[model samples]
Target: MKYPDLFPFSWFKGFRPESNDNLETKSPLRQLADIISSSVDQIDATFKDRGQKYPNLDAPFDPTTPAEATALSPEVIHCSSLIVAACAHLSATVNIPTKLLFDVGGGFHLSAALGVIIEGNVVEILHDHPSGLGVYDISAKNGMEPTRLARLLRLLATHHVFIETSPNVFKNNKLSSMLDTHKSFDTIQSKPEDKYVGTSGISALFAHTCDEVMKGSAFLTETLTDPDIGASGAVEDCPLAVAFKFKKSFWEWLEEPRNEYRMNRFMLAMEGSAKLEPSDAILRGYQWGNLPPQSLVVDVGGSLGHIVREIRNAYPGLKYVVQDRPAVIESARQIWEKAIPSISDGSVVLQVHDFLKPQPILDARIFLCRGVIHDYSYSVAKLILRNLRDAATENTELLIIDTITPYACLDDNQARVGYGIMGTETLPPPTPLLANLGKANAVPYILDSQVLVVLNGEERTIGSFTELLKDSGWKITRVFTISGSSGKQILAAPV
Candidate 1:
């Protein structure tokens, strides 16, 4: 059976069409509507040209499929971002003030509900019964209350996560199935601790985000209000501690024996984050292949050496030293030993080191710090940078792979500073849209808050990064904003 078009005209039926006049003549609301309509048309055309249909919401998500691959094209991604931003803007503009505020306030219920179903393996259980499972049966399998499970599933269905096939039966849909661990229901029941291992990691990511991040966020107001810890940039006093009443830092807390599974899940969640980006996003950043043969590259705080494994495959001539905490280094060693034949060789060395300490390798060609610096305060980030700077030779380069946040409002300075050594310019959104692409470029802002709550850290703006780098005796040499990458690649050299 043929599914309807991805963005049917009826979807935009309520959006008013402006006259065929130029954009300046149209109102802001009309401009947003136009963006939505035009983006939808562009997305539709791209899929048709590719001879692929858009996946419907009713089906389960399969990223490996051709239809899903088509959605990854840069053109499709840009148009999708436009539609998401415009729709959100349009809704906020027209929504009733009281109703909008209440909806926003009650948003925690959604995350709470998701946390419940994910823990209960509701999606996995529902996956077996494609025809839809009765709430009573689902509860019997998952052990949630029948009535409560039905209510939670209903709420998710209203959000398009699942579908209510009948009065009390529910089935997994595209959005809901994304959280599936892909393990057998029996396997999950037998060993719940191993549910995240050898899985897609999406479920672990959701669990971490909803359970820990959501809990920490609950105390954001209180953390900000406390006179002693509120303005303290120390990691030990982060909002996570405020919520959990833990005396140790977040990392130290994760290392406790009781929290081993939590820590493992967190690592898997970090790896799962790569699923958000293109497969070769790491290679897209720095010019690894350009280096001379046998050039030494150090990966600081590189958990499991996953990023380096990709880079090593692409640039086989380069040698690597992957550094992290002891437990993480041991895990990386096991993984590398199995995956690479030359694991015993000195080509790829797994080192147990902390970024807080002084660096070890003094003559490396490049120091790769992916997803590391963002988890610290300015002072701590400076120390990490300074350590690398201290160990660097005159020719050494430092590649910081992390998000360089853009301001929400217009910033002429950012518009002028192009990314990458070739000076590739950033495209500004059309007039009436936000300068930072609104929700399109919202992750950095969202993560900024998340890191603040959890680690007393933040996702840095380009300006913040520049200042931090300069203070640590490094200069921003170039930056590469790779397509589908979670962050920009900021390449620096010792000043």
Candidate 2:
């Protein structure tokens, strides 16, 4: 199969690949690591300036009394914590090249192949075999070579995907067991009726990410540099479109008859992501119980009504209408009717509606859009918000549930100066760390890049979100951070 073109530097005239000798000096991670190392002195100086004895850098700083609090500025403690966190980030970022190199060199293929192997009951056979299956035995069972299989298994084991017990012998571990097709049997009870190739949630998600998303990611630079598509926010100009040389948007491309299997896998991956994501955040983050009796909540772009169903179970007083494309609505109708018959009785309505178009439902109490806006560009996101804004009354609340990409150094006093952007509040860290939680917010940053590469979209900063909402004639009322989860809930109302 033809892969998308790898990131080409030809478009960037002056761009030269950094050599190993200069990589450290040129690395942002190295700069961060240096900052962390130098911060220790600043911590000591702050203590001394405050007429307090400096705490040993090697010792843990635990302030128990008022005197201790006075001795150490909250800044010092925060900086110390940040140092620890930054070190970990530096380590991880430095090692990223190894992982990237592997991915470039058939890592995705290896992972998918492994998923297939585990899906095929090869792991179960090995488990049952007791002595552990050798390369020859496993290869014979799967119709592959002993040497190649051993090498692949060993490479995977290096990353803890499986256990290579005593060199050639291999066995499934906790991590690898997740790929087992029967893993869901205990929870699902019955076999999955879906005809998707890989039924395992993780397997499906992994396969989809590696097989589809990775292909698009490879040509991200090429997509950006193409004169016809440079910096275009249109979905048709997205990296995925450019990579596949498709004239249609990502959704339209997926709708093609030739991409049936790909579509199924993509849907399965979404389902899988839903399972892994903190869906309960919606339940805990919002006050659904506070809504008036029989208030209608429209779930915009809610695939298969999964989120609505979960919310409904918690707050049954509120009625729900799950809106999506016709096919998704049909699938949702089938799934919900079979699982929740009452959903068919108008209590939980499945509406076949495109979010880009004006919302047909009027006067909805709540318009909940989760994991939707990040799939579009700023222009498209504005269009979506505007569509909702038109249908929404003054009382209608627009709850956006998605990742709120945090800005770096928001807590720094200098950084906040002259930054009059709304929703850019400086969150106080527990002294001595960088204000934006530093490495803790790494996933959101990575996700921001993923959205950019895949959809010509973004995981917006609070400021960006505020700007987008303001432009669409809506004002953010409040932002709620879901505890123990990366998802955030932004509540807005029409201006």
Question: Estimated TM-score per prediction?
Answer: 0.92, 0.71
Residues 1-495, model 2: lDDT tens digits: 111111110111211234546654555766565547656666666667766765332222233543356433435544554565567557656677877566557655665566455444455446555446787877765566778777867877776666777879887765565554443322322333343344536566665666666677778889888898887899888877778889777778898999887788788877776665555767876789999999999999998888888888898888999899888888888888888887656888888888888889997999999999998899999999999999998789999988876556543532453134333344443222345555544567667766776788888877788789999989887776543355668888899
Best by lDDT: 1
Clashing pairs in 2: 74-431, 75-432, 77-431, 77-432, 78-431, 78-432, 78-433, 79-432, 79-433
* Top TM-score hit: 1
Give the Cα error of residue 2 in candidate 2, in Å. Answer: 38
Model 1: per-residue Cα lDDT over 453-488, one tens digit each: 899888997778889999999989888866556677
**429: Cα error in model 2, Å:** 6.0
lDDT of 1: 0.82
For model 1 the local lDDT of residue 453 reads 86
